[model samples]
Target chain A: MTNLPQNEANDPFVDFSDVALRYGDENGTLALSGVDLSIKKGQFAAIVGPSGCGKSSFMKLATGLCPATEGSIRVAGAPVTGPLKITGMAFQNPTLLPWRDTLRNVMLPLEIVQPHRSRLRAEYAKYVAQAKTILATVGLAGFEDKHPWMLSGGMQQRVSLCRSLIHEPQLLMLDEPFAALDAFTREELWSVLQDLWLEKQFTCILVTHDLREAAYLADVIFVMSARPGRVISTHRVDIPRPRTIESTFDPAFVEIVQKIRAEIAQVRKESKAPARPAAQEQVQ
Target chain B: MKAKHRKLAEKLAPWVVIAGLFTIWQAAIFIFNPRPFILPSPALVYQSFIDYRDPIMAHALFTLTNTLIGFGLGILVGAMLGIFIGSSRLIYAGFYPLLIGINSVPKAAVVPLLVIWLGIGQPPAIATAFLLSFFPIAVNVAAGLATVEPELEDVLRSLGASKLDVLTKVSLPRSLPYFFASLKVAVTLAFVGAVISETLASNDGIGYLMLQAASQFRTSLMFAGLLVIAAMGIGTYLICAFIEVRMTGWATRKQTQVTGGG
Candidate 1:
């Protein structure tokens, strides 16, 4: 954590080089191709693109949930051959186990990932306290005993966030974690996420459809192309720390959102028109 | 409280329906003074029950023991087969059709075959009970495993959870409700299977007692045996339901209508 910006210039925490993911065997659908991405340690990165783009495929490849057909994916200076132990993932659906209470749901990762798994029983009280503390940060302190179905969509997402962060993983992968929420709830969670990221400073990769969400949370926003998705452009947000909903209206933030929105609109139009319109294969 | 009132009503509803059914049965007997062998009144059945209580209890206990043994075997083998089939797509595809084929053949028809192989007695009754009950449990358990949300699996797998971890923590617990639901069904089917095999070939059991009563034209005794069998079925069903509620109440909490203010 010693001035990571200065030290992280040479060595990246997550690096993908000429990565391509082809589903099935040869001549199958190509989900991603020629995708190269590098994110420094503790940097907040966002990927925004139209629907059907391989934004999610990138997350899978980065976390090693699925293997890449071609190219190399290295996270934390180690090549990812399988699911990495150092990563936490939250999906669009809260996906909390209904049988488990909020506290237990948040503690799920501890039951799997070690040394927490080994130490959990002996240090049960300590871990419960830790889970409670994270839940409090996400505004879920008093509702620890409630089941997932008892909580509303927004609160369930909060529990999901708490669960992902409970294990204290080095990399956090979020795939549209707030996409299902209403606008206001989504904005509130954006702040909740921002505070968590600011405090922990863990390397985060957020795949989002919301342009403003990408601009608000990400340090570097990567706009991907349509299917066979590759990073088309990356924009660095210079907006200051602890950005509020009000800061989103500021010209700097507004301009970045509009620019990315326009790029996504262009990608969406191109994808809709035809599978192959030009042999030129332009790169912006 | 309203919930208490509802619970009381739920507990009494079955008794009220049973009483009404008995009343109609008695009226039928009064309206048509048919021979006692044709249809005995509820009072006559009750009288026969009191007269033959000792033998009835003996046979009832025998059938109950056989039913339980077979039901237990069904659970063990069915659950094991279910886990084996459900956990892997290849196994599921291969064995699912075979299971359906075996299950499709009525257990009553299969009992004679079992009797042929195992010889006329408790073995065939137990085998028939196992055959009848195991299919539902296996199918339900496999369904439970198969229906696991892919997103949940992805979440667990991303946490570096092993296949065993996913199965133990998620798949097994997720299947509990399905297992219990099928238990209620399997228990009733087990009674049917046991009685069918007993009627066909057995030295003891309520089914054999009822067959003896029928041959002797002691219709009241046969009806009494029927009542005992019904009572056993209902009792086992209630036990299964109670355990289901105790074990996996979270699944049916919505139907039970918990008004949690979370």
Candidate 2:
């Protein structure tokens, strides 16, 4: 157990060995199967696959939002029974609380999760400062007191990012967190994420369908099959750190993206040939 | 400057119309040979205020208290139950239709029965207010609470918040703007309940006083009572509007807070 924590910190934080998941009692389709993966501590790993693949399933498993039907999954040397406290998330759209200003929205988790929750009243100032600092990190400093509707989409997204990282969790999950943004804003946030990850060195898991996004951000990229989504391949990104949009133009990143793209095409082709999925968008 | 002028024009138009209507009424009363007892006019509505100021004020206070109290309780309880129903399917399935059935029954139909059960008094009166007022609060609150974005809930959940936390922090907070909106409607309904109950059954309220003046052929006093009830209704309505404005500075911008899909 002692070596486990250190090994996690030194090597990787979460390990999924032969993980499998399914939805209901009808022996319905498997969302994921035979998924063995490890996201190293302080690493930015992205899961990119075709739509209908279990990229979201992988996210749910990591956060303990759902449990695997079979196999051993562990995070920080502990098996995930339910959601872990040491994680934070942001979604595609900037879903800031319309009732709260940007700062209070960011401080939401801190008031809910323990230790901080117990001390929210006493350490409100400190937490506010922390939220402001994170808002500043994402370039949302002066807009902290402004309500969510008053801000533009990009700004609201920045607040979302700030809210995710405000508590400074050990792991941050991003489920297509930038899919809703315009190209320029997406690129801007990519840098902001990169800077935050590099500074904090927190473990991260990002789910996206955009190949360029995976190639730009991930230290390792995992591709999954389309339906009974299994890990088709894991490609360790050999790109250097501190990457910019210019890095996306690099030959190496392009090659890796192309390779993943082909695998995704194959998976999608196979998925379409099989039996029809009754519900296309099963709320992931 | 042009924008500001248009905004001011939008606000000024309504008052100008109201002033015009009152002016026409004044002209009619003067031309029609109005007496103190017959068509005493808008002046009577005002002058009656100066005539029976103390008694009308006391009755207004009495009616106002019942409405405000019952309004408060109905809203508080209805909102809690509405959120409960909206959040859980089991509760919603069991209770929601029954709530609808209850609301569909005209509240005035049950006042006599309420008096029988609770004994012709404040309890019956208060119950009357609660029944009339609670429907809008409960319905609107439920609709508002139901429409919280699933994305927002997911964000909170992934942050390791419990279901209760998601409720209080995300769902409940998000529901507040809607609650305030429903609250506006609830306040008016509350006044309706109070005034309606007082009109039919009570002896001490402005509604009762109006009934007394009409029976005694005291037209001026009847007008006075009506002016007081109208003022009470308007006053209560304005208080609700004020509370909505003061509390929901964050709500006006949240179009999602209105009853609709998020």
Candidate 3:
């Protein structure tokens, strides 16, 4: 515990250096390439890009769901070769096991990750108490016994968030977690997510198509080009803590969103051209 | 009150339909005055049922036992094969078509081949039942496992869940509703397979009784045997449905909630 701060300061929690992922044999879909980026310890990073820019693919690579065909990825100063135990991910869909109620769904990670998995049965009461607390944080206090199908999409996603955080993972990966929700629900979840992240300060990476969402939640936003997705640019947000819906209207926030939107639009336009961009094509 | 009334109506609907069918059969027999050999009246069938109750009970018991045994074996072998085929793309690719090919060759057609290999009597009946019942279970279980959402797999996989963990914790549980569904279908199919084999070659059983009655021109007794088989099929189907409702209630609950205005 005493050496934790120093350990955190020395290395990026997630480091992708010249990473490339090809799906199949030699002539495969090159989903991601030259994805060199790093999230500093406890930083909230958002990745925004055009459709099919491999944003989800990047999440897969960082989480070690699949191995990069080229280059090295290091998380916490160690190379990532397989699925990392220190990370938890929430996808666009809630993906909650319909059979399990909210409390059990939230407790899913506990059954899979860590010393927790071994200890869960013995410390069952303690874990259940912990899960209840997490669910309350996500505004799901009274919905514990309800199955996912019984819950609204937003509530289900909240349950998914609680599940992802239940293991208290060091890194949280969210790939368009609120993309499927209605606008109101999406905004509500953005705040719910923001509060959770603020409370824990886990090193986070969000892959999303929503620019305003990226601008509102992320400390730094990475913009990527289309197709053989590459980080085209990076922007730092200097917004104050506890940024709200009002903050989204602030000129600085709006400007940041507009800039990202322009960048993505440009990328989309470039992708439409028959000729692939030279800069992105050249391997780093 | 309204919900309770609806529930009552649902339960009575099947009984009413059955009674109506019996009434229609009786009327048709009375009007046409066909020979009992062609189509026995409900009363005649009932009389035959009482007259031959002893033999009928014995033979019905034999057929039911064979069906149960074969169905049980089908569950085991089919579940194993389903898990095997489902867990690996390679095996699924190689064996799915072969399974389809085998399943497509009617169980009735296979009964003769089963008789040659296992000789006659209970062995052939049970083998035929086992053969007929296993295919659907295997296919359904495999489909259940195969159709597990990729994103859901990612959620577990990212947690460092082992392959076995994924199968046990998610895949197997997810496939339960499918397994039960297949059980409902397979149970009925197993009955058919057993009865078919029994008819073709057997000393005793409902099928044999029906065959004997037909040969002796005891058409009412043959009709009684058919009625017994029908009752057994419905009974087994109901039992399967009851168990399915109990075990995979979550799947059904989801569907109901969806229809009840989301």
Candidate 4:
């Protein structure tokens, strides 16, 4: 493994250096390339890009679901060898088990994660209390006995968020977790998520295509190029904490969104140009 | 409120229809004056049921016992094999074709073989029932496990869950509705298999009783035996259906909504 740079070695929670991923075997398509990223502990970062730009792939690598074909990924100062148990994840769909009720769904991770799994049967009441508290924190107090199918899509997503946080993981990975929700519900959840993040302060990496969402929630936003995706630009938001829907219209916030949009537009243009022979040769 | 009335009516409709059919048959027989041996009226069938009640009860008990024993063993073996095959792609690929081949041969052909291997009594009846009923349980279980959402599996896997954890906690529970559905079908098939073997070789089940009644030209007694078998089939099916509703209420809530809407 290569030695970390001096600053990165100090306090970076997640460090990726020259990371590249190719799907399939030796001659497969390169999904991401030449990526170097660092996120500080407890920082909320967002990755925004055009569709098919490997933003989701980056999240997979960070969580150790898939190995990077090249370079190294370090999360919490340790090399990610396999799936990291310290990370919690949620996706566009709630993905809750239909057979399990909300409380059981929220407690799912506890049944798998260590210390908790061994103690769970003996201390089930305590675990249930913890799950109930998390559910109540997310405004799902009365819905504990409700099945996933019984809940509205937005409510299901809320339960999913609670489930991810129940284990109190060090890192939260969200892959477009609210994209399937309505605009109204989407905005409402932004505050719910923001409140949770404020209270818990877990490190978060949000992969999303919505620039407004990124501008509203993230401490910093990273924009990526089209396929063989690499972070093309990173913008740090200077907005104060506890941002609301009204703050999204703030000129500084709007400017940040527009700047990121412009970067993506530039990426789109570059992607549309006829491919260079050198790039074609490398893919082959 | 209207749905509740409709549900009550739906439950009563089948009995009403059966009664009406029996009434029509009695009227038709009275007016046409058919031979007693050709078409037995419900009255005559009922009389025969009473006259042969002792023997009928004994034979019915014999068939019911064989069916239950065979069905239980089928379930045990079928579920184990189902889980094994469902958990692995290689086993499913290797065993599925052989299962299909075995199921395709008419079970009647196998009844004689079973009789030859194990004499003409409870053993053959039980073996035949097992051979006929296990396939649906295995196939449905495999299908249920195979169709589990990849997203759900990923959720458990990301949490450091082992393969067994995923199966017990997620896959098995997800397959309950399918398992129960197959059970209903398998129970009916088990009855068919038991009777088939009883008709071919055994001397002590509803099938044998009906055969003896036919040889003696006692058609009403034969119809009585048929009615008894049908009743048993429906009873076992209701039990399975009740269990299905209790165990998989989550899976069928949407179906209930659709029915209630209509």
lDDT of each: 0.91, 0.80, 0.90, 0.89
- In model 1, chain B matches the true chain B with a TM-score of 0.95
TM-score of each predicted structure versus truth: 0.94, 0.86, 0.95, 0.93
Report the C-alpha lDDT of model 2 over B60-158, residue by residue, as the tens digit: 888878888898789888887888787877888899889989988888888888878887646767888888887888777777778888777777777
Give the CAPRI rating of model 2. Answer: medium
* Residue-wise C-alpha lDDT for candidate 4, range B1-262, written one tens digit per residue: 8877887899899999999999999999999989999999999999999999999999999999999999998898888878888988999999999999999999889888887789898999999899888989999898888888876776777777899999988999988889999999999999999999999998899999988999999999999999999999999999998888778877888766757521
Write the candidate numbers in order of decreasing DockQ: 3, 1, 4, 2
Q: Name the candidate that leads on DockQ.
A: 3
Candidate ordering by lDDT (highest first): 1, 3, 4, 2
Write model 1 residue lDDT over A130-224, tens digit each, in one string.
99999999888899999998899999999999999999998999999999999999999999999999998888999999899998999999888
Per-residue lDDT tens digits of candidate 3, residues A1-284? 21356746857778999989999999999998888888898899999998899999898889899899999999877999899888889989989998898999899888888789999999999999999999899888999998887789889999999999999888899999999999999998899999999998898999999999999999999999988999988899999989899999999999989877877788888888898665443222
The stretch of ten residues in a row with the least summed lDDT in candidate 1 chain B is: B253-262
Docking class of 4: medium
Model 4 lDDT per residue over A1-284, tens place:
22446676458899999999999998998999988888988899999998999998998899888899999999988999988888888999898988899999999999999879999999999999999998988899999998898899999999999988998888899999999999999999999999999999889999998899998899988888889998777899989989999999999999988888877887787788897222221110
- Candidate 2 off by > 4 Å: A1-12, A27-29, A119-125, A274-284, B23-58, B213-227, B254-262
lDDT by residue for model 1 (B1-262), tens:
9977877898799999998999999998899988888898889999999999999999999899989999999999999999999999999999999999999887788877887899987999999989999999999999999999988898899889999999999999999999999999999999998999999999899989989999999999999999999999999999999889878888989756743312
Residue A257, model 4: lDDT of 88
